[model samples]
Target: MTFEYAPAPESARVDIAPSYGLFIDGEFREASDGTAFPTVSPASEEVLADVARAGAEDVDAAVRAARAAFGPWSALPGTERAKYLFRIARLVQERSRELAVLETMDNGKPIRESRDTDLPQVAAHFFYYAGWADKLRHAGFGPDPRPVGVAGQVIPWNFPLLMLAWKVAPALAAGNTVVLKPAETTPLSALFFADICRQAQLPPGVVNIVTGDGRTGAELVAHPGIDKVAFTGSTEVGREIARTVAGTGKRLTLELGGKAANIVFDDAPLDQAVEGIVNGIFFNQGHVCCAGSRLLVQESVQEELLDALKRRMSTLRVGDPLDKNTDVGAINSAEQLARIRALAEAGEAEGAERWAPECELPSSGYWFAPTLFTGVTQAHRIAREEIFGPVLSVLTFRTPEEAVAKANNSPYGLSAGIWTEKGSRILWAASRLRAGVVWANTFNRFDPASPFGGYKESGYGREGGRHGLEAYLAGPDDRPGERHGEEEDGRAS
Candidate 1:
């Protein structure tokens, strides 16, 4: 008999205000248009709070505020700036439990993940960048690097607070002021972070949070005052942002979607490989941009691997996001749930064999069972598309060369994984994998010190470590003692 664990829910310890407003210039104020929208809990369909919607005018105000704060902020000694980041990091750690519970409620991710992975990484990212703040000269980005003025950043809902840290920490470390927009579905943590800024006593306008939909993001990115733009979301939106900033000469970075391949060699340790596959695809309800949705197994061991994977998948607990024992949680929103359902339906229509464990879903909120598909081919929609859900497509490959070819066939180059005990073979396979981040014996691992990004359509511009600092700084040509005259078309010489 299977042991059913009793429900252990985390208490809602955070004090969320009934209404939230746009955080601009270190102050929380209502949108100029007085428009507000409700943010709901995906696990219970409960309305959490009313968030002010930032319109174009609000975006402009945020940009202006960031622009005004840039000079004094950039002029501060890097060590002084580092102190603020360190303080923020400490504050994050101090209030991690509150943030974790808030994130779980806001994002519909398992409480275990919000507490263990999300919150810790959020704090660590700030801590990692804090050290780099005072050491820019030795960071290999030329001598005495200068901050780019105001930056506009847009983050998605899948990993809200963590993504905020990924974008905001490095930008501040490099002495650039920022105007940030959290996804409409998950805006509370960003607002809470604004409070952290107040607690840290950070200078006004160093970090600003705007809450709204795509229109708000569009205005923020296209604002003439923004010196840089960083986005993390769908490939389609990333392309639009790229186009919007093309002729404006704004520095842009995008960390977009992926349909990563988790390749299992015949000689791999079966038990560990199955665990890796589960963690790779199902973590955060598979809302991750670098989720390993495609499983490429050697033909010789395909049946064995699939059997093990299915058995393991059957044990996953899917339920309340606040439950500490829940392995998978609710879909982020109704719209996202509909998209996942459509893509999953396409997988079945294309003749892939769909299989799912018999598990009960909460009736009221958005929920999708962990699913897997067999008899999948590279041409199958399930194999080719990014179904940002808890779904896996299993495809077979005969040799390492074929495995490499099949894995690299997708438009995304974000992440990939290989499971094998052979050192030489692992190195060879990793060398040929087109992904930005490759894991030989593990999957879905992240660190603040490692630079992460993608090639091709998955987007570009590395984030994290010393490389991330470059995204917020001016190039050598624009720095003091390195200013070259402008060309005929106003391009830097």
Candidate 2:
């Protein structure tokens, strides 16, 4: 069946504002060259609106404006900064539905996820960090912490608005100004977010949105005025960014790629483990950065778990993102769909048995049938690479030590899931795993009050909780405008 993008208002859901232009210095304006790109609805491959394609000149101007705002914004008392974040959070909550519709339209995530998970988490992010604004001292900082100036934030297409919250909220609450360039693929919701900021009466230039692809992101990163760069993207790009800003005094925090493992011990509750394993790999079509794409099951329960997983996968609904019953949604873009298809082909070519749920995919829009591969080994490309799609690699192991070895084998160690009945084993796994977050008996659970980031090549720095504030602040006795978050430890409960 061909896909259609039924307007949110036509369905009596909500009305979304058409978003365009480069938001800079608190003004929504056209790109420097007046060039525009059509933003596509992933559900229908239809043009949603003409979006600004920020040129290098626009990026420079945005960075300058952010730098200018940084002095005053950074000097504002933490209490005042906290209030601004509070105001923005309230505004986001007020316009949640509109934003949710736009998010689903652009990102191809089900309306359920965009509304229930993404929007709520985005707001709660601000709410969580807003309270931390005046409590920096208790956050292990000095009595008064200074803000880093002019943060250059480049967020990924996956979870665009939530990434905005991850990047913008703590920066604002810690008294820093930002020049944010969202992923070119899913720029709509963030543009709408700029409008909400205007309504919140946030100081002009405190937060700016420059829309463009990786080229625009490069410009923002290389801009001389930017004091720091925070990025959430692929590991390849993160490496390049690290190299580009190597010699500069600029600070960098990267949340990069992942090929996380979901380990199922023989003693685990089979029913719960099966459910957790399914959700870990297939939720959001497996677009999550911390997706448990690698399944390591103990040999004792491997066959039983595999049968349960196939049944669970068959129940997922793959259809219109707006449908109330939809569980899996469209692939975000044709390019992403192609990537997923290509990787799945590779998995088969490399000697894995590929299996996709028996479901029809819409023809016109980008879509991939949920896929899984059994008989996978560490040598399989599917097991080693971050497919970033609804593809799971199944592997079996014998002991806890072997499971840990397999889980940590990936160069990417972002997050891991452990399913076990023994509390001691759970604690041992959590402690031994190099991942930033460990879920025991649960998978893919997120709370705004939690600090999230990865270890090693998966990237550095945290994005939530009190730990997030450290990335944006300086101790009171530090040098003028110097960053003091280098010593910030991750101790979030």
Candidate 3:
């Protein structure tokens, strides 16, 4: 006998304005050119809202607002800043359900994730940074650490609200004003967050949000008034931003791309390892930057692990993002869907054995079934490129040394996972791994107090905890400006 889950869609209603203007200072205004673009629901390809597209003139205005607001905002007592952050945290929690529904509609992520994971973490980040706001002197940065001033921040669509929380909470706590540009595809949640700022009675210009595509972000980053730039997105864009800001006296931090690995040893518990592997790659439809897309299993247990992983993958439900039972939701955009499809095709072209569950997808929205490729090699495109979709690549290793070698073979060093019961083996593998954050036994965990970022091509500057404060705080020898954040690596809880 088999049991089926009934459609359990969230019934909450969120009021999204048909047209939204840029949130500058304390009010919303039309773009300089008065142009707007439609933001669509990836789940159904439905046009949700017409959002104002920020141009060069609009970006300059936002930077100017942030620049003007920085003086009073930075001069506020740490305790006062703490009050505002705490208020924002409370406001987030108060309207979390509404935000969760909005997130599901706009971002095409499961309601379960938006409600259970992203919203909670968003509030927690603000609360965590609030605690640090009044205690910055004790954070080990310096006795009088100064704000970086007028931060120009760009965030991705994967975890829209959460990424905003990660960037905005810290910058505000460190006493910096911000001009934030949410990704083109998922700007509704960020725009709603602008409303949350108003509800919290946050000061005008302290958290300006400009909604638009990559051109808007580039304009904001290049603006002369922006003292610092913080961005989370593709590595290709990150490299370009690095070059754009080099020697320009602007402090810059980038949290970019990754293609992480999840290693399973011979003695690992089969069921537990399978679960970890599933969570590592399939969470958020594998939109996470630190997703463990590569699986390196010990040769002795490769066949057994493959069997278990396939069984688990067969059970994942792919459907509406708002459905409570949906495990994997739509890909964020049609462009991203094309990329995933291309990479999966490349895996086949490269002689990798591809497998997926017998899952029927919704007819409308952009979707890709959860997939895994076996017989994969480090030289394959699927193994090296960041697919950014719910696709896993499996490879085998004969020894621990080989597993580490294969795991570290990628240019990305954001995150990696090790599964084994032995404490010593976990330690040995973790110590030798070149990734920034290594998970043992479990995967895809996060917390507000822990620092997250990557090494090498994965980009740099830590976000969260005390180390995160360093990015926004001026150095001892520095005058008043600097830049920071994670590559969205697996985290604390």
Candidate 4:
């Protein structure tokens, strides 16, 4: 007998206002030009709320507010800053249920993921950074490191609240005020975060949130008043921001795209390797930037692994974001679905064997079944490009050296995973892999204390752990007469 799960939906406990405005200087206010756009639920195509669109004028206002708050905020003792972060972290935990449901509604990810993965991480990030506030001197940057004034942060929609936490928590803990802009497709949770700030009674202008499309991000990055810019998004947009901030004396950090590889060795445990492959690619409907989109398996185990993988894929449930039993939900938007479809078609045209499980999809919402292309070579478009959806490309390698070579062949060096029982081989392969983060016998694992970022085109600078604090701080050399390698006589030794 086949087991079936009862329909379990989370309660809609969070109240979303019909419309939302910019959160600047500790208040919700309208855009100066009165421009607004509607945000819709990707699962049902229902309009969730109309959010104000920030233009140049509003970006300028947010920057000015952050600049104004910088002196008083940065002057506050480190212990006081730690108190504010602690409050924010506690409040996030208290409101996890409401935020999780809202995230499922707006972002079209499964309720289970929102509750289990996203919300917990969001709260933990704040809690971890809160501890670092009073311990900066011991962090090894400098004895008297200073805040870099205001930070302009722009985050993507894949993990809206989590990304916001990653950006805002460290910036605030380092004594820097922030002007953040959530992605155009999803802004509800960030607005709700503004309410959390109010409940914590965080001082005005310490954390400002602006909502809009790419133009708003461009404006925020280009604003002369912003002392630092941190962004997480596509490589195309990252390049644009890099050019915009060039020669402007602004500190910049980017967490961009990736096409990570998940390699399975013949000596590995077959069952666990299959599970890792599934989790690495299908989690969050494959919207993750560090997703293991490319699968490189040893030729000896290729047939056995493929059979097991297909059998596992057949059992995955795809539908309703609110359903607790669902494994995959709707795509984030219609445009993204189109891109996935086009790339899948290209894969077929390039003579690769394409396969998708026989899963039913809702008629009204944007949906794509979990897909995989086999017999893919390095020259295939599907293998080279980032599909950014629930799609996987399969290739084969003969040895550990070949696996490492194929994995590092891509322009992106964000993340990669190795599956084997040999301890020495794991260490050797990890040393050779060009990615910033590598996992052995596991995939997609993250921690608040572990620094996460990428090498090469996947973008620069770390986002978590001790390294994250440096992005928001000014080193001793930034001050007059405190230059490194300088003698007391004010000349280089």
In terms of lDDT, model 1 sits at 0.91
Query: Against the true structure, what is each candidate's TM-score?
Result: 0.97, 0.94, 0.97, 0.96
Pairs that collide, model 3: 445-491, 446-491, 446-492, 446-493
The per-model lDDT (C-alpha) reads 0.91, 0.86, 0.90, 0.91
Expressed as tens digits, the lDDT of each residue in 86-148 for candidate 2 is 888999899888788778888988888888899999999998888988777788766767776
lDDT of each residue in 121-161, candidate 4, tens digit only: 99999999999999888887898888877889999989999
Error of 2 at 478 (Å): 3.8
* Residues forming the 10-long window of minimal summed lDDT in candidate 3: 484-493
Give lDDT: candidate 3, residue 359: 89
lDDT of 1 by residue, 1-493 (tens): 6888999989758888999999999899999999999999999999999999999889988877777777778778989999999999999999999999999898999999999999999999999999999999889998878887678999999999999999999999998889999999999999999999999999888899999999999999988878889999999999999999998878899999998999999999999999999999999999998999999999999888888998999999999988889999999999999999999999999999999999999998899999999988889988888999999999999999999999999999999999998999999999999999999889988899999999888999999878888888876567411222323321223
**Model 2, TM vs. native:** 0.94
Where does candidate 1 have its weakest 10-residue lDDT segment?
480-489
Off by over 4 Å in 3: 481-493
**Candidate 4, which segments miss by more than 4 Å at Cα?**
479-493
Give the C-alpha lDDT of model 3: 0.90
- Report the number of clashing residue pairs per model: 0, 0, 4, 0
